[model samples]
Target: MARRVPRPAGAGAWGRSMGQGLLRKSKIGDNKSTQVDLWGGACMVRQVENVLLVLEYFAERRAPATVAEMTDHFGWPRSSAFNIVSTLAERGYLYEPRARGAYYPTPRWLTMAQAVSEADPVPAALTRVLDRLVDETGETAWIARASGLHVVMLDVRESPQMLRYVARPGMRLPIHVTGSGQALMARMATAEREALLKRIRYQAYNRNSPMEAETVRQQIADSEERGWFMSNSAFSSDLAGVALPIRIDGHAYAVTTAGPENRFVPRMPEIAAAIRGAVAAECGAGALDMTPLRAEA
Candidate 1:
């Protein structure tokens, strides 16, 4: 049996549940654990999370991993762990630098990641707009697009301040409470917006965050008239944000500026204008493309 992580409590844990205890054990899953079958899918696929966890192991260990070591760490059968590691080596993602040595990842994965980032849907025009926001507001600036019920940060330029918001690319924020999420959700067609809203697993980290759909609806309605939205300590006690949606290359996305509440709220007017002005200046009538930045499962 593979070792299991103790899942964190509450709504956030949904982001990490990848393989739900593969088929029950092969000498390789004990044939059930390494590859999991979807609830009704006709074809079963190898658990992608295995590959990710393997990579994470390498990253944290900073050392090559042998098949025996992999099996012991994950509680997998030796053969299964061997197969998984060998498959990665066969794919050019991993290599045995030393003959008869343990395997380590090659640069292929990094090269592929660079290629994908270059091909991102966010165009140079929008990135320039994000850059301008970061410069003008001295707060972290980012571009976000909706993925199902969450907003994903596609590109970000962090603030230079000593206590600025640190934004990670590909981070997901819930739709109902984040300014970026709200901006993107509000721009969706009414039916689509309402449907997505109904699916929200709402929670509040602080008093300022709206904990119900109706509250968010009212917030969106009010922001619709103003053309921008704000989240005051919504995701966490200190994080605050402001955003305005824009269309670039025929797709919709939001440009957001965020920072610690103490410093960020006072600069909201300045940050908001920077975002709006940059979009107007760089894009003119162009729209933001919002195709998923990740492969949909």
Candidate 2:
């Protein structure tokens, strides 16, 4: 089994139950623990924690930290400290210069970690809800979140029909052209909404999809009035999407939907209710629900 890093001193022991146990065993896991460290050798949990701390510090902002910084932070023996980091580098979790010993997380680590997190319960729960939506209405389902002046399609389950919504991860669309984006905009403050609009250019990418700044503002007002956002060929020429914001602690993180122009219009009310019900059930009325973020709203 791989060893896990211990929780930091200030973090409540009770709150760190799962994380600390993994540290004791020397492994970090997603759902089921995959034993990456199979040497059956006892690894120092504190050393692992120190390394993870360094990795997190880098992950947050992408600055390379020196060995001195890590050692000062953990107070571990130099040899053990270097070895732990070296092991992580070898496993593609981090990258370090051979001479300088400065370290940063590798793309491989981010990719693997993203895969694990997506498969974990939070996103899994969202996916299950989306799947149920597809089963219930025989339509495409989407879960999207605001990213900059656009909406990022996080996850989607396509309808079984020959012509269905075919969007993938990392797909970003302009906020003005998307129902999901408009729903999020409906809940944002005026300054934030205007700032976002200013940041994104109102360039006409296609002939029928002309969205000026004023038009976008009007759409947001309409969404707020209707309690939902609806678009017929607002994004794609033939596709429509209906969206509602996912709020946790009065902040909007994302929107959930049943879409694809073919099914969105006729099923707007039902899909909107499904999305509302799912968000309410999944997030509840907690202030601390979902991962913390500065740009949640």
lDDT of 2 by residue, 110-217 (tens): 687679866632355567767777776676667777767677667766666544555444456766667777777766667777787776666543344546778888
Candidate 1: 10-residue stretch with minimal lDDT: 11-20
lDDT of 1 by residue, 1-297 (tens): 223331211111112111111111113112122332112122324467677767756754577777877787677788888888888888899998777668899999899988988786678888898888877888778999888867888988877775666555666676788898888877777777878778776654457878888999999888777667899877656677899887764577889988778877888877777787888889873443333222212
Predict model 1's lDDT versus the native.
0.69
lDDT winner among the candidates? 1
TM-score per candidate, in order? Answer: 0.71, 0.54
Q: lDDT of all predictions, in order shown?
A: 0.69, 0.58
Report the Cα RMSD per candidate: 9.3, 16.3
* Top candidate by TM-score: 1
